[model samples]
Target: MNASVLAHRSMLAKGASGAACLSFQLNEQTPAIFPMRQVQEVIVLPAQQITPIPNMPSCVLGLTTRRSRVMWLVDLAHMLLSQPLPSNIRNYNVVIIRVAQILQQQNMLVATAHKHVLLGLIVPTMKGVVRFSPDLIQTPKGHFAPGLAPCLRGCVLQQDEMLLVLDAEAIARSPILQSI
Candidate 1:
């Protein structure tokens, strides 16, 4: 769907607590959310649409076109949890995130630059958008799976579900994805 994240963000700013987010699942047991501002779109892509590349990270599921623009698709579970999607799956629930971030780099001197990257994360299940107060987001202690530590922004207990807030910029700038 074509979501206007800026619109959602503004609508959620009733005070200082709420933020609009696009929610999905990494697997059956792990639910997660991405700040709507950083998400570009969500789609269900057929398995035949992706053309797999050779000798890349296992998480890298190769490339596909989104609105005629080519972008890489990754298996979010495999990339973060060391678990791949079931082989029998026919379509992928993909969340496309676009991150525009300032990155610091050093050579003989330190400098900053802006990068815009788009990546499609294929999750096992794609839930609709949700809004929760930012105050409810908790720090990610060592309670989560070890592989999930780096990319986690925090966790939120929404009702009875533990929704993981992920770092979109971190995932966009991942060394694995950057190793092209």
Candidate 2:
């Protein structure tokens, strides 16, 4: 195996099986991370790829197709902070993630099987994978912004910065996303 891959494996095996996460910027000001295992892939596409859907929540950027499956593209910044991305931005790096089956509600009417539903979260910049020792993850003390609290799994301090670790499953099963 390559040196980088070997290093990643070693990190994953460390500290009671530490969690590996993909760190990204929600906006210029907000930094966050999501479990790497939840992400299927990351794609860079032009703004034109997103077809705007009218009457949808502002957080829902619209729909796009990948590997013949329709995926809902959501604005993570807007969802978390009510701040839409700048209109001048013309491209996005999207993280494609599978919503964990446990997040699906029994009564919800879903067009596709719960396991197949994929969400594309739009992030302006990706900071790469970071591994955190399980011991370093702290249970949130209800100190996060109200909008983001529900979707956050916890927070961890890395290099003096607190990175909110988002719960991808919770985000996928969010009422707002389900209503779409």
Candidate 3:
């Protein structure tokens, strides 16, 4: 876990209320949140930093070194929005996630043996941290984008706006990303 996020978690654990999460703008369009537990770090990565690989998933932006270890970067817009990201962008807003969710339907042994996976998600902008009760998350409406449905935990209303709460584990395990 990132120190900043750990601090945010601790602060919430003490006196603050609800689940702490970071809300980010997906392609500077739809709003979404990631539970703090899955977030390792949030960074601004220059376009030049990534080393492009051949014959990879379209969603994969490429690999970038983070803390001396190489991590694959995925364009969240390309994945969830099912749209091409603008090529004119100069930098990427990356949210590094460490996925180690236990598979509930799997046998206990296999679930227990699961290792943490690292991947960087690129978003257009971040909306800052927010706290919302788990019960507040609701099923997406019929009009919701199909591409984003599987990766979503649910939706929540924040200041009268619908904010999608994403499941990082599901995003990390996405089939398009799996091809990388």
* Tens digits of per-residue lDDT for model 3, 68-105: 88889999888888876688888888999987745556
For model 1, the local distance difference test gives 0.80
> Taking the tens digit of each residue's C-alpha lDDT, what string does model 2 give over 19-62?
77888998887788998878999899688888889999889989
The candidate scoring highest on lDDT is 3
lDDT of 3 at 36: 96
In candidate 1, clashing pairs total 1
Colliding pairs, model 3: none
CA RMSD of all predictions: 7.0, 6.4, 7.3
Residue 36 of model 2 has an lDDT of: 85
- Tell me the spans in candidate 2 whose CA falls farther than 4 Å from its real position: 1-17, 101-114
Give the Cα error of residue 71 in candidate 3, in Å: 0.8
The C-alpha lDDT values of all candidates are: 0.80, 0.80, 0.81
- For candidate 1, write residues 127-160 as lDDT tens digits: 8878876755778655766657778999876655
| Model 1: ten consecutive residues of lowest lDDT | 1-10
Which one is best on TM-score?
3
